[model samples]
Target: MFAEEQNPTTAVAGRRLSDQQAVAQFRQVVSRVEPVAERFCKQETADRENFDCDIQIVVDTSMEGRNAYQTYNDAGKPVVGFTIPMIADARNPDELAFVLGHEMGHHIGQHSHKQQQQAVAGALILGALTAYGQASATAANPYRYTGNDQRDMQNSIELGAGVGQMAYSQTYELESDVIGTAITKAAGYDPVKGARFFARPEGKRTANGRLSFWGTHPPDEKRLATVLATIEGIEVSGGISRR
Candidate 1:
């Protein structure tokens, strides 16, 4: 989707790629994102005594065709894992870099850890309320947390757990784009050219959209607009926010 010299640092995930090809794409993506990730987190990573994270990329078909995501190991090392699904066919390196950057942004912004903590806290608070009510007035159960209630609770926690966490995630996406733009540019890629695939056409939707309360990603237009603005700003200012 991009000229190598023109836009060298796009995320590369395509359909039905071989294992070796996928690894090659991943290495290229890491090479693109590493510098941006470092620029995004230099102050702490540069300080050996105060290092906050170590990022590792794990590629496995066993992930059953998932896109890139951030997971935290017990030691709290941030692990970005990707499945074969994101890239449906053979894709260029730029496509891979964007996905790689998105996953990196999850760690860079600390959203994964914060969301994990928020979900747990929300559930615990609700559980305590359920328990206290059960003991108080001989109320069989105030929280009939099953079936739809369970589903609704889950959705609420995911979508409405904390103030603007969802919005913050959206913002981080823009941040990642800016970082990705710079990183890709340095790695010899055009960030905007790579971002075209992310645009959602009218009437078309992802399967995840079929869910009742799928609140993970911003609507495509919203995400695209934000990313475009970030890229434009970077093109004009040359990486102002990170500093």
Candidate 2:
């Protein structure tokens, strides 16, 4: 996030660019990434009827944090949103490119839908177990089957669903990193330096193990390593040279 008094100049392609200049560069990055998204959709969804790559980029000035996310609109089209603070926080065009590519990776990988499916499956299993446990309890003591007991059972099922959703969140985050590295490289950006954004103190600070196993994202260190390895592998294979 950026404070109101923060400097307006940002680094872009090793040169300082004002906020307006940076925004223009960000738009150019979006333009380059759009074709990459289209190519991915063509390769991944050619068999499906009426499937087309539709990605919309939204800049929300009202947002408070340095964050970006991918989601589907009401029409099922993928949307990537960047907060003003996030844009302001980006030190260079490559940082913005990597962030945009990362969000695109989420859509390209269909992580949103896949994660929902995982959560639903987990919730169903948990709900079944809770039902079985409640039935067993009621069978052992018929007098225990009261309104409060039913409410508690419902609460347990909800809690199980929440836990289930979190269980796979970290997995999806890692997967996104892999895909995002490729996407950033394909867009002709230096994913390695872009990845260094995660190595910064603020980025490292966010990876605390408070939730550990239940965290929504893996530790920043792990993510940084994955990005480094992925980019190295790609280079070794002569995929794309570092920009």
Candidate 3:
């Protein structure tokens, strides 16, 4: 049912999570999914970092837009934090687990810094291209030019970056979903119920046709389809198993 990719793997940048509200919610997510994710983290990263594989929930004031993420300082300390609105606004426990798992998935893939670095690099490259294009275009059509061309060029670069990022980022998201489902299940919740969490992306599906859910995330159908597959693999109650 999904259009692109689906599976819990890794993620790009996450929302800041160092605030009181964010901290409480992140702690709740940690309490629920750490058991399962911990093992995955150790396995994924070979326990090479100082993290000891225990996901720590913290608050971040610099975040906005219901985000969660893993961070590493220049000193090589790794931290995993989730945002408040992300968990608080979740439709159910599964969604919360999905967010937490996705963030943890970034750590699992050892891509926390790489993703952010790429995004920043993409922005810089786009900016430089925009300036160069503007200068060259000015020589060609100086009098007819509006700043919109630069904006459009920058937009295209960002758009391309976004698509490329999702191509890879979605892989991580799907991987995290799978891993998150297992963790949420192990935490004693029905992952099927948590699958509703995937619905949050639907709100962004305003356009129709081929571009639906293109810029924001992997298509909803793809996400739900993967989650359903995950649910099938787990030991649930009746049709939906509980851990």
Candidate 4:
């Protein structure tokens, strides 16, 4: 939803929650999900000491996007930022919880660090290949210069980096969905209902084969299916006690 057109007061849990109220609700959800995040950290990471399993939620009212994301703060701590529009768009606490869980999943999965490593590796490999090709071309004919070799090499490296970044982008998104489902369930919310937020009309339209391969996120339908399957598995294992 567009930030300019969104209502400042939105409904959450069948009642009107202003922006301030929404922020409070977000904090409450985060507090509930912290134990789940800690459990994931213990299970996934070996260096638990350096990993700041504590998650801090920041409500950015000045932000434009109807989205939330996870990143490291200046203090090297995991922080999730919820844009005002995203908060305004949520229909209930469960939706907010799902979004928060997804962002936390990115951190839990160490996707940011992994993606950066992949991009750097891809750039180094591709840059070397480009330089080798340039040298070979120059050796074949010193005067057969196509254009600026430096510029061409830079372009190739950038392209390779982009490809590397997108290589596992869809996979990361799907993995986040799975983790987020588990999180929502563990937090005593209905993961199935939380997944419905992605099945909204706007989400469906955006996922309709628009740059399917290049986009960072998987299609909403695919995400919904993964969430459903994950929730089913969790239920079978009695992983989460429904509230």
Candidate 5:
């Protein structure tokens, strides 16, 4: 279904923009979307003290494949970055705008912060369980703690952290789509059209075997549906309302 919808020969995906054109469009999209995103961030985080809306949007020239991300710098300032290929792969300004909005949504949603907390909690829970099981076995057999107790706990903790991070991954993606749709529309872009960027059939890994955009942001019907639903809500409300 995705392949049919994002047919390279017939759709915008068919043509690749020049490096110069790609950069130009990205900058233009940023000019329009950045302010709106910042304002939205501020509005959403008004009650929080020192919640930084000073987002830094940048491009990673050294990275390969289509990808974008939101992270915090050492000073705790939000940073949204796009790989060079990600910019070049964008079919239109709306795509760039929506992608930028989505990245901003991650920060605004405080996803990273929440994910870290979840990781720590999950790790503790699983690690404690492992330790308790080890102690019980040691008491029962008196020889079960020969060597692998620490290794077992460490492995369990790592696995728990991964599971915890994944627990709300899909929900977070949908939430970001909702926020992105609002920001894209506010920035005068067609979010539904922009979201078509995700409709293309891609693999989890790129040619070099590194994780690709689709690897992290797996394209699915649910995501597109979320965008459409958000648009519907926006139209009904005559504007976006925080959820």
Candidate 6:
């Protein structure tokens, strides 16, 4: 889904680091990027109230696949994590830096909060529409309480919630890339090079039969375009624009 300029193979392709090398590189990247990301997060969320900018970085050694994520703890602090495989799978430190920054961007964008709201709104709208249809049908035929109506309405509501959650998935990803590019650059990594980690030619799952990184962070031309555009803006304006 990328053009020649955005090809996946370059610089670090086909180069696999040893386990020791990989772990060391991951730690080095985290040391540099984590502080930068936290500072950036605070700066971006300064005007908002109760915005959690205390980002905690963690590693899930039990996870066997290549994946990273952002989640909240029991106390609502943002936690960004990278699996062991995810760290080992990185071709270079730039990839790890970019991935961490992207996860931080999710928090900066308040995506989880917005997604929950959207899902509720979508579920309510679809449930109401289904209820209206059922009522109309019952009005026409008073004998239409076959238990299928409730099941169908429930299914519609679930589908609507899923649709709502996904409606802004692409946009959210692009926004993260925009923020990630700026963060990666500020952390002394090349955002474009880091983004190339996504343009791999592989299935959605890894060899161990678990979902791969691409399964969640699907690559497309738009993602590359966004990173490039963000880099351009940073170079021209010397900072990231407010999203």
Ranking by lDDT: 5, 6, 4, 2, 3, 1
- What digit string (tens of lDDT, one per residue) describes model 2 on residues 46-110? 88787647788998677565567888889888899987666766777677777787787778677
**Candidate 4: segments with Cα more than 4 A from true spot:** 1-16, 46-49, 201-218, 238-243
Model 4 error, position 3 (Å)? 25
TM-score of each: 0.63, 0.79, 0.56, 0.81, 0.93, 0.92
Off by over 4 Å in 1: 1-17, 43-49, 87-90, 120-175, 200-215, 240-243
lDDT of each candidate versus the true structure: 0.58, 0.68, 0.59, 0.73, 0.86, 0.84
lDDT by residue for model 3 over 137-168, one digit each (tens)? 78898796575985687686786566445445
Model 3: residue 137 alpha-carbon error in angstroms: 17
For residues 193-232, write the lDDT of model 6, one tens digit per residue.
8987776665787787776778778877888888998888
Model 3 TM-score, 2 decimals: 0.56
Ranking by TM-score: 5, 6, 4, 2, 1, 3
The C-alpha local distance difference test score for the whole of candidate 3 amounts to 0.59
Best by lDDT: 5
Off by over 4 Å in 3: 1-26, 46-52, 113-166, 201-219, 234-243
Flag the better candidate by lDDT, 2 or 4.
4
* Minimal lDDT window, size 10, model 2: 1-10
In model 5, the clashing pairs are: none
Report lDDT (Cα) of residue 11, candidate 1: 37
Q: Among all windows of ten consecutive residues in candidate 6, which has the lowest summed lDDT?
A: 5-14
The residue ranges of model 6 lying beyond 4 angstroms of the native Cα positions read: 4-14, 206-211
lDDT of 4 by residue, 63-174 (tens): 6656677899887899888887677667788887787788888998888999999999889889999999999998999898678998999999998898888788878888
Where is model 2 more than 4 Å wrong at Cα? 1-18, 47-50, 203-219, 238-243
